[model samples]
Target: MYRYDEFDETIVRERVKQFRGQVARRLSGELTEEQFKPLRLMNGLYLQLHAYMLRVAIPYGVLSSRQLRRLAHVARRYDKGYGHFTTRQNIQYNWPALVDVPDILDALADVEMHAIQTSGNCIRNVTSDQYAGAAADEVEDPRPWCEIIRQWSTFHPEFSYLPRKFKIAVTASPHDRAAVKVHDIGLILKKGEGGKTGFEVIVGGGLGRTPYIGHTIRDFLPKEHILSYLEAIMRVYNLNGRRDNLFKSRIKILVNTEGPENFRDQVEAEWEKIRDCDIDIPREEIERIKRYFAPPAFEALPGESASFEAARARDAGFDRWVRVNVVAHKVPGYAIANVSLKEPGRPPGDATAEQMEAVADLGERFSFDEIRVTHEQNLCLPHVRKDDLYAVYQALKEAGLAAANVGLASDIIACPGLDYCDLANARSIPIAQALAERFAASGEEEDLGELKINISGCINACGHHHIGHIGILGVDKKGEEFYQITLGGSGAEDASLGEIAGRGLSSSEVVDAVERLARFYKRERREGERFLDAYRRLGHDAFKGAIYADA
Candidate 1:
């Protein structure tokens, strides 16, 4: 994790002070709600349907045990006893008082964390593969680059107050776990011709009302030129991106209007002028950042632990959890474990203060004091020893975090919909819960196999429903909740947006519709075919028949 320097500390402290005064003025009626809106948003505060919501950034989804503990403390002391982990790998407290926001920011600053850029139109938290440093297949860790971008974009005078929110994701692995293709800017780190690590830059990818997979703008950009290239892209967007309409304000809209090829040419032209400018990341600086993410010390040991094998043989639940939660690590004896937040019938990506505290303790005890939040909205103990897997599983199970549902049909990704979000027109959580229960009751999940079902309450696609093997989008129809289903979308290396099957189903009919679709896939799939593969092979016609046969 990148530690905050004095400069970083000072800036955050000053910003907190400024926000405190702004809040005071707003409450005092000196500033109207319209005047206070942008300021509050800039600080990661939002006025929800009922109360204010504060989203705190957990940079690159990396947190120290201390920071995790502090977050638990905040959850307990400030608002409700729980917080929601978002798709962007940030945490949101749904009920924070406007008057106490400065205090909340102060508490976050104490742990070297803040809500800065977690919201607003400027660059939000730069995210990456949660398994960046530990993944065996990675060419390089992507966190350092994410950190570099975070630093450059934070309070950037030139790029602040963009037409809309900007997102950037980086991944060093051949597999696109960070969903880079769907970001405003995506960087895939790869080995260049001379075996030098660099970035494959993709620009203008986003999902909202209009979704797009980013177009590759630069096949290869040397690591040192990353910041400079990013600046060039931002400069182009700032100068040329539409400001006339909020719906057409995103860079994706601009890219679509100009065509990707022309947009690429424009970015290249801008890059040529700014390639060696002040933001040109120096080699020394990059090295300095990289050092922070170097792998932790590990003792070499046998790949398979005798004790773990014994536990698996003895405990069926533990065995199931181990199968789904544990991931292969680069280190011989260590494994990365995902602590699932999507337990059956619960809000997805939500952790109570007690569960958060338990995870912090486990991270300290078993994961070398480090915790990671996956883009999939799960907590990770990134460097747990294989021998300790059973013990960690037991602890997690006790805390209700040991659900063996990672990447399964029941492990749904859903946003805080109309229940919490002002922009949402429908409720997403209840639908997710209903579907999860339906799948669990049917015992049909095993048949489904490696299915991803993501739900977003609106077209913002915050829940990443656009890429699910089965995607569900909630919409408002005359004050009633309705859901639209899409099939065959994927967020991996071969990324594709899902196509809607047919008419939107009412909330009551969605789970049954999904079940029907799953049943259809089971009957129609070739041997060993996954849902996505089957969907792609058979096309929407098969699923459409299943969903609308009785409609």
Candidate 2:
């Protein structure tokens, strides 16, 4: 919700102007594909299998109704009639023409949005909890800090081209909904001594060919020095991170090779050098950023809504939806409603233009003119009145946006695998669709409580499969698609990379394999254990046996 200041506006407009010229040159044959590769990447454009893809940044996953409408417009006019919301909380247009990209950038600039830093080797979109300011458990809102980092890192010449792409995420809540531990840099906000808020910085956490749960480099860094401290971390990585092998270029590889103790020492030494510099953030600017994220004017009302309670009593389907999709808000008489994009039998994260428009209208009418894109590939209305729940449900239900699977098995996270990406070894969307249908048909989706199934087309880990409770990675065996399963992975506060269970399953066999494993988990779990917990206690061998026992 941070409106662009005049300075921000100028920066975006200038960026658009620069990209427009670059795009014109490429179209006119003045620039070859090789020459334009980095230029296009710098602007978040990619050459996929079938056509060019444009990824637009939704900063910290916050969107105004106006921005949402702009995205809908882009889908309607520029590409196919839909866009894919990615695991990074950004949206992708899979079939945009190269000539139309500048126009898209200009349109985004008009709405105070941009594709800058959504791709390339520089820091990617700085993400945070979708429930940031609204969640009851938050220590403080993290978006202002994210905005500060965005201001500092965007077009920062020093970090323009690193050895590999960088990503940062912040989570104010202890729950770690932002998958902070799996990012290149993860900031966990907490109240330190003397009631001062600070960050517990985690570095070297990322998932790709090599996976890591970032090590804690600093236990407590005061909020005032966040930028300076981040500068130190980047300086250390830039100075010594690998450049010889593309596969070994990420900060996680560097940290693992150097060892966490040595890496920590390097970061601390760099911090000491720059901590007292003029990089200290201004109090007034910090206050200004904070003001944009202050809670919406919520009316004072009683804790319960009579109509909502009555409706729940009357409609079992709606009651089930409320149980799964609705989350508690900090304010009384308000709730956070998560709109599921992972409807059964559809590809995960694909939102049609019409559905996007429907969400935009619902946000404007019922949720204070704002919508949030969840890292789980869903949309959230962060400030819905409890009294309007049924009407909101009806609106969403009619628009094909009302699936009540939030943390359930049906809410899958999948990348556009071989279907879109050139780097993919296999297809991911069909696997997700198959599993969704399998679960729905068996009536097993609702029975499996709080499961996360993440699928990646390749080891690039764009699907974040490494952190799912059940992780599925597509691998190619002599040009055939096969899925390798991993269990016990989680992206929460207790973040861990999933362990590979056993041999790969054919695409035809993967869905039934997943159901078999789920039934196994249900039978083996202790009374209070979730999938990850059950896996930890029961061990991988037991689950592996479950998958192959009946095969």
Candidate 3:
């Protein structure tokens, strides 16, 4: 994990001091709601439907155990005993008092964490692969580069106020766990000419009212030139992206209106002007950042752990959990354990203060005192020993964090819809809860295999419903809550927006509708086909026919 330096410490302390005064002004009526909107947003505070929500950034999803413990403290002391981990690899405190926000920020600053850039029209938190350093398939850890971008973008005067919020993501794995294709800027690290590291850059990818899988603007951009290239892209978007309509302001809309080729050309022309300037990070600084993410020391152990195998043989529950929640590590005898936050009957990403503390302790004991937040709304112990898998599972089980439903039908991604957000048209958490319960009750989650069901309160797509294998978007229908389903969506390497299946289903019908889709897939899928593959082969009509056959 990246540690804060003297400069980092100074800036955070100064920001906290400055925001303390700003917040005091707002509470004292010296600043009206309109006057304080941008100021509060810049500090990651939002006036939600019922209360103020504070979003704190967990950069590139990495956290030290100490940091996690601090977050747990904040939840226990300030909010309502829980925090919501978000799809952007951030966490939200939903019930912080207006006057107490500065105190909360000060608490966060103590642990080298803050809410800066977590919200606002400026560049948001830079996210990356949860399994970055530990993944067996990775070209290299992407977190260093993510850190580089974070350093470059934070408080950047040029991109301080874009037409819309900008998001960037990076991945070093070919498996695409970061969902790079759906970001405003996506970078895939790859071995370029002479086996040197470089990036394949994608631009204008986003999901909101309009969704798009980004265009590959640069087939290969040297790692050394990443900052300059990103600057070029930002310059292009800032100059030409629409400012007239709120709905049409995103870079994706600009890319669509001007076409990818023209957008790429514009970026290239801009890059030609500044690529050689002093904007790119120095080689020494890059190497310095890289040192922070160096892999933790590992004992030379056999690839397979006999104790782990014995535990799996002894316990069916342990075996099932290992099958679903554990992934292979790049290091022998180690594993990346995903902690599923989507327990049946719970809000998808809500982690109780105790659960957070439990996970922090588990990470401290097993994973080099580090925890990772996945873009899919899960926490990860990115470097646990395979031999310790059972112990970790037992601890998680005790904390109610071990659901063993990763990539299963029960592992849902849902936003805090009308439950929190004033922008939401309908509630999303209940739908997610109902679906998870339905799947768990049926005991078909394991059988379904690698199903992603994402629910969004509204079309802002905060839940990333556009990329789920089965997407449920809440819509208001004559004072009734309805869900519009979409099929064949994926956020993987084969990223694509889902097609709307058919008419909206009422709250009661939506869960059954999802069940129908799953059962239909089970019946209709060809041998060896997953839900997504089957959907692609069968198309939207088949799923639509099954769901709406009785509508």
In order of listing, the candidates' clash counts read 0, 0, 0
Pairs clashing within candidate 2: none
lDDT of 2 by residue, 197-266 (tens): 9999999999999999999989999999999999998988888999999999999998889998999999
lDDT of each: 0.90, 0.92, 0.93
Q: Lowest-scoring 10 consecutive residues by lDDT in candidate 2? A: 439-448
What lDDT is reached at residue 202 by model 3?
A: 93
Index of the highest-lDDT prediction = 3
What shift in Å separates residue 195 of candidate 2 from its native position after superposition? 0.9
Clashes in model 1: which pairs? none
Residue 133's lDDT within candidate 1 is 89
Name the better of 1 and 3 by lDDT. Answer: 3
lDDT of 1: 0.90
Q: Of 1 and 2, which scores higher on TM-score?
A: 2
> Candidate 1 lDDT, tens digit per residue, 347-385?
999999999999999999999899999888889999999
TM-score of 1: 0.98
lDDT of 3: 0.93
